[model samples]
Target: MASRLAQLEGPIDTVYADIYNESGLRKETTLSKELGFKGKLIVHPAQIKIVNEVFTPSKSEVEQARKIIDAAHKAEKQGKGVVNLDGKMIDLPVIKQAEAILEYYNRLVINNQ
Candidate 1:
């Protein structure tokens, strides 16, 4: 399903792991994150908090994203479009993904505040 979504030319921003049980949902959320899912689908209102907490990027993740974005920007300022971030070459696509993650994290923080 994730592969199919990636094959589409248009963007598929989020994927939901349709689940209900607490522990099951927690496990599913973890797998979904590994699979690049940005949200979860829940059947009950009680699942809302769990889903949100699971989907929100962790503090460490947000910090990593900030570092990636900063590195990319620094590279761009130096007339280089690609950067080696922790031994991996980061270009436009990687930078875009980092930007997206930070954007989502920022939105969540703003909404919570």
Candidate 2:
């Protein structure tokens, strides 16, 4: 099931696992997050905290995304189409992804507060 989910393109969201067991749910939620799931479906109220913690982007992830956007902007200002960041090439797709991550992070912050 996870392998099949991995093959799908675009933003994948809402994975489900056993809801009765908090430990098992946490593990599955973490695994789902690692596999690129944007969120999870919760059948129990107790599951919410674990799923939210697993899916929220870390501070380092947000920082790295900011750096990616900054690098892309710098490249554009220099009349270059792409830039190398941390030895990896940053292009349109990567820039868009960084933008999406920051956008998602912002939305989460706004909604949570």
Candidate 3:
């Protein structure tokens, strides 16, 4: 499992573990984080709150994503392929990525109902 996770993308924040085995739970959570899982895991309903608390992005993350999208759109209107944002060069692709994050975040919020 660890080996598989290593080949995946950054900031992966989820893992599934058996609820009955405390040791396994600990091992999985530890390895999940060490392997870059932020705070998501598969468990019983009793554990949903904990997993969500661990995985949800903070206010600052939402703010950053919004700013990135805004800057990217402004750059696009200016016929610029890339623009500087907080010292980083961001192009349309980067803006699209940030937009996707917001979309995904919205989906999560919507489906949670």
Candidate 4:
């Protein structure tokens, strides 16, 4: 069900994890993140930390997103519509995704600070 939800291109912001079980919450949150759910519903304050941790982009992900944005900018400057990074083609959709990731990461940083 989570996998199917991930397939939807529309925004997903209402998935809920097990509120009574911490372990179950962790697992469910992690799986939801891996499956591309944007956010999860949490009934308890304790669930906030785990849910945020699962959804937050990692250091490596931020770095990769920066690289993708840089590569895309370079390609744009060169009048090219696509670029290659780490031997993989970086197209518009990939660039957009990377930009979105960075945007979300930046928001997290700002909010946390």
Which candidate comes out best when scored by lDDT?
Answer: 4
Clashing pairs in 2: none
TM-score of each: 0.75, 0.77, 0.61, 0.79
TM-score of 2: 0.77
User: Sorted by TM-score, highest first, which candidate order results?
Assistant: 4, 2, 1, 3
Q: Would you list the rank order by lDDT, best first?
A: 4, 2, 1, 3
Q: Best TM-score goes to which candidate?
A: 4
Better of 2 and 4 by lDDT: 4
lDDT of 3 by residue, 1-113 (tens): 56446754446555465656655555665666556455564658755655554445556767788999999879888998899999998877788767866876676676677
For model 3, the stretches where C-alpha displacement exceeds 4 angstroms are 1-41, 110-113
Candidate 2 regions exceeding 4 Å error are 1-17
Please give, for residues 1-113, the per-residue lDDT of candidate 4 as tens digits.
65456665434556454666878777877777777777787777878888888888989999999999999999999999999999999999899899989989988876779
RMSD for all candidates, in order, please. Answer: 4.1, 4.1, 5.7, 4.0
The CA lDDT at 54 in model 2 is 77
For every model shown, the clashing-pair count is 0, 0, 3, 0
Residue-wise C-alpha lDDT for candidate 2, range 52-79, written one tens digit per residue: 7777777888899999999998999999
102, model 3: CA deviation in Å?
0.6
